[model samples]
Target: MGLGLGFELLKTEGAARRGRLTTAHGAVETPAFMPVGTVGTVKGMLPGSVRETGAQILLGNTYHLMLRPTAERVAQFGGLHRFMNWNGPILTDSGGFQVMSLSDLRTLDEDGVTFKSHLDGRRHRLTPERSMRIQHLLDSNVTMCLDECTPFPATHEVAEKSMRLSMRWARRSRDAFVERPGYGLFGIVQGGVYPDLRAESVEALTGIGFDGYAVGGLAVGEGQQMMFDVLDFTTPLMPADRPRYLMGVGRPSDLIGAVRRGIDMFDCVMPTRSGRTGQAFVRRGVLNMRNARHAHDTRPLDEECRCPACRDYTRGYLHHLFRAGEMLGPMLLTWHNLTYYQDLMAELRRAIEEGCFERRAAELEAGLALGDLPAVPDPLAGPVAAPPVPEESSSVPVDL
Candidate 1:
């Protein structure tokens, strides 16, 4: 009884697509970026502010919600929209990734995975049917299937074995999902970095069918070039009639590359997470607010950004807040980063519509290539300051 999730492909440029997704809650422009709102809230941000940043949808984690307040608790409060004060569309993952990555003692099998909760160590079981039911309880507008996210660097034998297991789970998830108007299920394609396995995964998901298809098992350990390589070959085979998503991806450049490769939807915690750690995503790339050089600087993070942090504050002031360990620092920066991401998406959509995606993308990327603005010369040129710590490596998993 499942139906298409009301996706309308309005335009295309090369491999890029411009479209819209209509859900029970609202409509999201394609090439859209969904900010991760794990545990029912986007950390350091209010729903009103997130909306102001131009986000039409938020991605929730089924594993986190199922553990904490629980899906039943959310349903009691009239679903995630009402519960979180976000009236827009919501997408929830199947809890498989978290079970595999976060949980301590995880056991995988055909029926599902059994593991202890990362938060409490309480035993729990997650099958395809249970995952579907949890998303239903949360009233998710877009529900992801319970697929095993295969780890990177595995042998072909290992990758194929994992992918095949996920394909079998996809069928179970498809059968278990209850079709509701304006709400739909998406199947994840998992094959590590293998092209043949990816082709097989695409075939498996499309054959069983879904409202949309998501390329998963990427951004795990594969570098950016490898990720692009996977998309280059794999995206062409995906059903264009349905929306195509790239799950758990990525930086601004990554988003740009993916959009250029024809992915319509994406979700990631990079922006918000960086915001908390004193990193600001600006037009000229990431600027560190924790640096001492900014202590006396008075310029805004990005002159082009309209976020309050930029419009109303200064780099010196932002630096002061972070140095003082004020909570407002993270909030203001999170708002700014989200606003930047939305602005990027809007520009990409506009570019695709205007048939100038290549030029626009080139310009945007070249801006980042220019790197952060040159440091202003120190007034006194006094004793040298501490060397800035390198931005944390992405390999280490951080909570969304």
Candidate 2:
């Protein structure tokens, strides 16, 4: 066995935990939010900007990089960090999720998966060994085991079969991963929404051993309540010393709820993806900046936000940019959304450390429940605006 990765659990309040994770690139405080940086780059922001947002790590997609530039090319360029100009820690997914979601044709068997690329019509095969190799080439600090993301609504029988296949893959992945100091592999637990299956998955992964553990196959359309119910039983069973990650999870409320349930790390595309669509995640709730109500409003997206978009510009300007199809619109919103997520994580860590996680969680839930503030009325369409003129019929006899 390799020298295991360092994970120091500092404090715990109820199920909430405050800890630190030491990686090859850097140390990440627990209850961390890893912005999705698929394809070696976080969608619209610069590396430095991402750091400024308080993000210590990013999650890269193994499926995308392996197909596009190819892992060999990324390795030639001194790995993903140098290539993407991000010097922080990176956790790479095992490509199984994307293979099932994005690919047109896919066949999964005990050996592995064979699929056609969504990017081009190219054929590709991904086994646990190949998945391990791809992440290794990318020089990822945290590598996830290749496992099927059990589809939601699957029968108990189907879920069991999928979970068993993933368990088999987990063993192969563990064996295939090359041991190196400061680098670690994570095992994924994949058991749809069934508590028994989830428990079995946890037993299997823990038996094989991993530096960290991730609860996969969630946020796949199962509502938050069900996801939390899974966590209720699942997280308690995870090894307390190792970091616990919830993959592809959720809105701000989802993050807070998961953290309250003892999840130490999370990765999601919601922030960046929503940002691109003119949505801003604020303390109160989500704001749709594309609305006409913001057309003449001069207030910032969130008065408390320190992000450049909120610090310097008005909602009016953001609305105009989106309306005008400006690229900067997405860039600014993405930066702000990422900053918001990191800030939330920081707050959670602080709460847990202070032994007031429950209070903080209640506060977060209350704030989210408030929803978006009432939109500012259009300033230009005041009562002094011009009145509508009645039009006379063209056939009317009128004197000029």
Report every candidate's CA lDDT. Answer: 0.93, 0.92
- Residue runs of model 1 more than 4 Å from their true location after superposition: 1-4, 378-400
lDDT (tens digit, per residue) of candidate 1 on 324-370: 99999999999999999999999999999999999999999999888
* Off by more than 4 A, model 2: 384-400
RMSD of each: 8.7, 4.5
| TM, every model | 0.94, 0.95
RMSD of 2: 4.5
Residue-wise C-alpha lDDT for candidate 2, range 81-199, written one tens digit per residue: 99999988999999999998853589888899999988777889999999999999999999999999888889999999999999999999999999888899999998888999999
Return the lDDT, model 1, position 217. 91
